[model samples]
Target chain A: MSFINYASREINLKIVYYGPGLCGKTTNLQYIYQRTAPEAKGKMISLATETERTLFFDFLPLSLGEIKGFKTRFHLYTVPGQVFYDASRKLILKGVDGVVFVADSQADRLDANVESLENLRDNLEEYGYQLEKLPYVIQYNKRDLPNVTPVEELSRLLNPGKVPEFSACAPKGEGVFDTLKAVAKLMLISLKKNEK
Target chain B: MLGSQSSLVLFDEEFSNITSILEKLLVEANAKALFLVDKDGQLISSTGETDQMDTTSLASLTAGNIAATGGLAKLLGEKEFSVLFHEGEKDNLHLSLVASRVILVVIFDQRSSLGLVRLRVRKWNEELEKIFNSLEKKAKEKGAGNQSFFAEITDEDIDNLFR
Candidate 1:
């Protein structure tokens, strides 16, 4: 849920980055953290395992350019990508302002991507949110990998709804902010529509 | 808006001092919003406009989120977690445990850099530890002196359990 603090002239929104294991969701965040301006971010907190599996979520707070004189603040979060972490995933999605479904665009990981997508929809439903109506997007990630699947095929299988998709190689920093901008804009749109 | 209830000092000197210090850090960092919540997930105070943020739910859920994640980490035979982060397209949230009693939340924009944030948190957290200890000492004194203050918090505390 986005909080509009008229007293402070600011709005705070929560966004969750989600995907299957090893799909570059964490990498996507690390890259953004590295590239953001010195004044626009806070500590990048990651709850990960010894082997690097996301335990809880990775958090990074950022400020988008202000809109209408109100500083637009975005609180970014990522769910554990492993399948057994479903309960934790649902918990993190609570009151989420937006979602970026980071699909691992690899032949072997197609099932993982689809399963994660389905889980996203189910979790959203449980939270009384319509997947089609929420502020959401898809990023076919790890595009630079040698065995990556075609973007069209990845979108067909994962993003059948076709909500603002991007082809990204998170490690090399390609298309990361583009995806961020698209989702931020969509989240703002959702907030505006909610106002009316 | 809160009335008929005995005023309780949730932050005490520790909470207030930390809050003021945190506010400066957030502003210097150009963060959008920030807050300090206790281990039980009760919101103590907030800097930055949280009218839309719902620090209430965030506090409860964040404590839950931290607890659940800590539990998972233990199950997997790992150590306890002191920090949590979430990165999305346009926003990010950082949850850092302060002196194991309070959790600090920092929300900022993509326009700011993460390296700077990490640097400041590392410094601010140390100061917070000392201040929290000082508040702890104050609480002990409060308990020894008035006693009613402690009793009041006890009543409120037990009242909260039933609630």
Candidate 2:
């Protein structure tokens, strides 16, 4: 949830990165953590397993300068993308302000991507939120890899609503900031609309 | 759903009242710090010595810890876990739920005992609950009014942040 603390002159917003298992959700967060200026970011916390796979979630708090007089803080979180981790995913969605769905672009992972997207819709519904109404975006990740699905096909399947979409190779930081900026912008716009 | 868009308006009066209560707890419990965190991990207020601590991370992690514990509580047929204590080698943490919407976190060193911390927290919980209850009520009643406070913000202001 976004907390507007007038007393503190701060605005805190929560954004979640979600996708299927091994789809580079954590990589997106790690890349942002590395590139963000030290003063602008907090320690990145990853609740992961011995194998480095996200076990629960990954959290990175970032400050994106000030708006008006309030400092804008964004808490970025990633859910465990494995199928069995559905319960953990549901918990992470609580109070989410925006969502970036990082879909695996490899052709073989298409099923996993679709399944995960459907799961996102269901879980969001459980919380009384409609994915269509929320500040949302899609990232076609792993674009650098061979055998990746065509962007047209990916969009046809995943970007039906045609929300802001980006082709990202997270490990190398390509489109990382673009994706972040897009969602952050959309989230702020949504906040303004919500206010009205 | 209690979505993030719910405007949490903390007036100066409410902030001062919460701060005083926290200061009192810090003094009576002989603790290092006391933090009021929303269930979503936003730090509402804090008192005591915390210049060296990363309260942002602390608030997020504490809320995550409490959420995990609350999930466990549900599995065990409990509505929620009211309090949790973790003792470390030199420091300890006490987490409790206030009004089921916010969390009260107390950190201490060997200077204070768990018994004393718990005792002080119990005495202060009722007051904090009343404060938060009214805060929530005011937010609901003044929802549109609060929006007007930020109505002055324009798209240009938001875009300026990205620049």
Candidate 3:
């Protein structure tokens, strides 16, 4: 859920990076946080368990220049990917504006991917949202892994609708911003705003 | 000037409209679930497809998190605790305070982006401020006694869960 504040002439948007455990959601944000220009980004906050898994969530506030006169600011969030944290997951998706799904490309984790998507749907329903219609993108991450699934196969299963998909090796910074740009474009399309 | 009785009507209307706006948001964000609960964590409205959402525990946890974080923020002299994000090894939780009247909770897949979630929260906050202001104004007009159009929640409703 994003607001175009006419008073301040600013458009604030919230985007959450979501996926299963160890699926590279946190890595993607870390990559972006490191690569982003200091003037355009904020501190990357990660609240995690002792094991370093995101305990609750992570946040990165960013500025994406201006469209017309409104400064389009984006807030980035990542949820703990562990399954038992289902309660925390529900708490995070309250008033979301856009989403980027980072699907793990490992063949054995296929079931995890599917189950995560199901959880996403169930949680969205709980919040009075429908999964099919949101401004979303899919990134088949960890493509560098030897046991990764074929991109085509992953695409068909994860993003059958063909809503923009990216092949990513997040740790190396491959396809990170490309995924972000695609989702941001999708978000702008939903608002009928010209992309800045 | 509109008197008090009419203000309550405005508040209810604003809340109703915000729910519709939220429905569009759930779709836009591709969220798995979303919730708008009051400070007490009572469910006011939800838009996405929640299959077995336990609003009871959802409200309780959300309020607890906000209170806890709010306390931490004040301790750190941050002035306000606007939002809290939890990224786990498997799933993630994003919680943002909705104009102090309510809390917005969202659950999403690892495929979603934090920036998008925060952007939407700002947008939701913009609209929510208006809704709360209208409702507050309506309450002022009506003498501020009982303004909630949603439910007849008691103090026990909030205290029972903690006990």
Per-residue lDDT of B1-163 in model 1, one digit per residue for the tens?
A: 0111111233334555666898988877677788876554445568886878756557655766676766677678876688888887787888888877667888878766677677777778889778766765654455344333222332233222222
Model 1 per-residue lDDT at A183: 87
Model 3 spans > 4 angstroms off: A193-196, B1-64, B67-131, B135-163
| Candidate topping lDDT | 2
Q: Give stretches of model 2 more than 4 Å off.
A: B1-5
* Best-to-worst ranking by lDDT: 2, 1, 3
Tens-digit lDDT string for candidate 3 (B88-137)? 87557788886665688887777677788788777767887778677666
Residue-level lDDT of model 1, residues A77-157, one tens digit each, is: 888999898878777776677899999988899999988889999988876777788789999988877888888888788
Error of 2 at A87 (Å): 1.6
Calculate DockQ per candidate and list them: 0.03, 0.63, 0.03
The superposed Cα distance between candidate 3 and the true structure at residue B30, in angstroms, equals 43
Top-TM-score candidate index: 2
Q: lDDT by residue for model 2 over B1-163, one digit each (tens)? A: 3534465667677889999999999999999999999888888999988899889888988888887887788789998989999999999999999988889999999999999999999999999999988988887887888676567778888878877
Error of 1 at B54 (Å): 18
Give the distance in Å from residue B41's predicted Cα in candidate 1 to where it truly belongs: 9.8
